[model samples]
Target chain A: MSESYEATVTDPVSAPMTCDSNPVEEWLRMDRMPHIWCPGCGIGTSVNCFTRAIEESSLDRKNIAIVSGIGCTGRVAGYLLLDSFHTTHGRALPFATGLKLASPKTKVVVYSGDGDLFAIGGNHFIHAARRNLDMTVLCVNNFNYGMTGGQVAPTTPEFAIASTTPYGSVERPFNLPYLAQSCGAVYVARWTVYHVKQLQRSIREALEKPGFTFIEMVAPCPTLFVRRNRLGDGLAALESYEENAVIKNGADTRECDLGMGGPIVCGKFVDIDRPSYLSNQVAHLRKVLGDRYVMPDAWQGVVQ
Target chain B: MVETKKSAAPKAPKGHVVINTERCKGCGFCAQFCPTGVLAMSKGFNLKGYHPPIIADAAKCSGCGLCGMYCPDFAIYGVKNGRKPESGDL
Candidate 1:
């Protein structure tokens, strides 16, 4: 390989031994380890950055909730120690919106894979961004349906090989950032696993921001996506990310579509403040009721 | 946002990583992500028949913990003098 890291080596098999405390254990469900992800899968990298973002954001852990849809990345909600919900496929966004509206104070985070988010749940995604719900959606775009054995997905780069697309995919891929921006998402960013530091920072920013926020994490599915395509192992995918990703903050979202092979643009494409659903509702109520409608908290006290 | 001190030396602290060898799946993430390139897949194999990474040079480690962040299995973490490397204030 042209890279300079020690990624090409394999030792002879040996007997098992005991392991010790994991530093990230506090953020994880210990009984779940070792996780089901392949040795070099980048999902773990996103999880690491997320936990770090939580730690760095200083948000109250009890008030933070994670919602995930069914997929390989959907397993993230089950792995996290926070209050998390493993929702049905393509439903994490709507589920998170319910949670956010119910408790407004809680920081809801939607974590799921591209297949779950873009393929089936895509409708909810656009509407949520259009309404500007107050929540953060983190999508791990592995470019295929990872849990379903590498089927073609909405985010799979055009012409990439998948189980369903044995010869090559003849479909166009979604430019996620452009979709989110056009739908009025307030904060949007994209990062690959190779950009861990920047990814963590962007996640932290997403967590702290208001209104619908979306961050796309480009990770490797070495087991299915990589192997099926003859791409090298997990680390090789990471090396590719390092080599091909170009960081351009504030780049136009329309130009961020990814392809099978080429320079992948990464950046914070959008960040702006706008009235969220809750805030707009509250404002409308205040203006229309003219002091006749009591605030929900006060009304609850009266009912009790 | 709190600003981190820039007065500190740019070099990372001298650190060592603890590889939970048994848990390692021989991904080489630690070796590949370490900024100082302080680790490498060793000739020895773990129980899973995967090659676990080993510290190639203690002096070269910066204790930045990128390996820990990149590690999908959480089988590795960096420690400097028995404590974690300093993190920016929350």
Candidate 2:
């Protein structure tokens, strides 16, 4: 089957250009070329979707601010030539929220890892969703802590073995989409690296959304996770994702249970319009602070 | 002067990166390594607060496979334009 599929996959050289019209390339940080992800890692796939979405949206790089946290995924902010913040672990969202509130015109995005968001930063995640801040939160779930070595993470499945869980992880994993919906995120969706086109479309829509948006991407961890679990190589893991993932309409987080041994659900889980935190804050300030909030006397003043 | 008819150029082969989530831990390793500025972390937590890596650009992959190689979890890989070289033939 692998041989047959390989035979059918298009050759990179002859494949039709799907990304030519994307304008983000003009501002790509080529100096950061040869990024350091391991072979067969899915973060590259996620990156592809992100750039495509930015290109399709035709967003101005000058008006965008990409923020990230600690771990491999957090490096995205540094790689982009646009204004970015390579911040502390599990704090990408908070920083992004501050940026969005300070500059309502700028499009702030927080890119972070599972451990950063779910483990240490779980509280921040829920608040960000509840507040419905005007920002895009893209979470890259790989299953274990890949940077500091593969340890059992909050998303690690029950009975999955990790460095920390030598006998297999007994803890249950969190259902991301359901959590986002319940917390009031305006937009929520899940996509794997395989569905590149759909991923790009969803991202573009999420970015255009007026309120907080969350996209959970299912990527592979062939090195640590696969090696620890003995799940073969990167290609084999991708094949597994292709086999296990089931695309269904109106799928929600409640329906997905990593411990249940069911089909992996993938689709646009939710999209709704709500009052953004930034807009609400501005309104509150206008009502409360009023003229008492004195404007800075000078745009760029030099104190004598 | 003779008018020269301009022809549309052939499109370049577009490459992309893909992730296998079941094998992913949401480690954010790939998000850190993408050179073309395409990947990002998900805001929501997966079954594990591990918000799997997402592809932000399907077209800018350049087929480098750097993320896949650097991924400690090996959750990332490349989908090139052409078929894989036949086994025992490469």
Candidate 3:
């Protein structure tokens, strides 16, 4: 069957007001433009949403800190022109928590891949969520570890084949949204790169939200996931997301199981206001340490 | 209709279009398609030795993605304000 493409030019649903499209050069390191991610990789789209969220948040860039772990998605820290730390694998959350505790006013963000977050860093992920830290954690779930020769990750489907699993994976994948919700993350949402506008909106909301805000982006890893699964190309995987994903209100984890080949649920799964770890830490510190602590006058007394 | 003092000409949106230096070939398509006298050929050359377009009157930009969509090579992209959700503004 031959496929015909149609272009539709619909009238604006609202007024035709002009808005500024200024290049955010300061926020972006132009040298880092044309990123290192493979072509058709959804990490770029997620990165775009992240940068747009930061721009829209109007947060003080000087006061913002980004922490990332090892993986393809972890490289986001290097692209962003902010106070970022490219830390060891699966340790982004701990470093971000430290930064948040040191400077409560600073906005801390953690960017990692499914392998880094759900595999080796699984323990840290749950503990961090349980603590309700005031930070935005973006976990890019591409089903496999694209950076490390496409190994099967904790989020890989039960039967999906990977480099390590030549035949098929027998182990089931972790349900990210449900795990986060159960672990006590205050805000949780999931979106694919196909839903750019909605993903950007969710990122913005997550940035503004207090406590632990976890966003699981079901990104397309064309190089590994697609090639092995015979899913055509990267654009084909993106089209699949556009066709298979559904944006439903109040959608829960039970309805979006990857193992059962269910519809990809994309929306804000949970959002509730709660006191963050920093605030609670400060209160505990004051109560325990009392007023005995005083700022040192000079760096001479500090020991490395 | 009662005539009031002519309102000052509405200023166009600022910094509407952006050119990706890596993909842009300085084909002058953007300048050709620009309805307003905002974009022009830049004196400097890109890494590829192409004279990329530059915004002459940034204030006159209308945030239209015409240049971006028309470029043979998808070298340009636009991000308009207000239409994008602004976080922490609330």
Top candidate (lDDT): 1
- The better-scoring model by DockQ among 1 and 3 is 1
DockQ of 1: 0.28
What does candidate 1's lDDT look like per residue over B48-72, in tens digits?
7788887676568665678888888
**Where does model 2 sit among the CAPRI classes?**
incorrect
Q: Please tell me what DockQ candidate 2 reaches.
A: 0.05
Off by more than 4 A, model 3: A1-24, A259-261, A284-304, B1-21, B24-75, B79-90
Interface RMSD of 2: 13.8
Candidate 1 residue A274 C-alpha distance from true site, Å: 0.4
Among all candidates shown, the one with the greatest TM-score: 1
lDDT of 1 by residue, A5-51 (tens): 23321111221222354567788998898888877789998999999
Q: Please, what is the TM-score per model?
A: 0.89, 0.69, 0.72
- What are the chain B TM-scores of all models? 0.74, 0.68, 0.72
DockQ of each: 0.28, 0.05, 0.06
Q: lDDT rank, highest first?
A: 1, 3, 2
Task: Give each prediction's root-mean-square deviation over alpha carbons.
Answer: 6.7, 12.1, 9.6
User: Candidate 2 on A101-162: residue-level lDDT in tens?
Assistant: 66677888888888888888889999989998888999988888888899988999889889
lDDT (CA) per prediction = 0.84, 0.71, 0.72
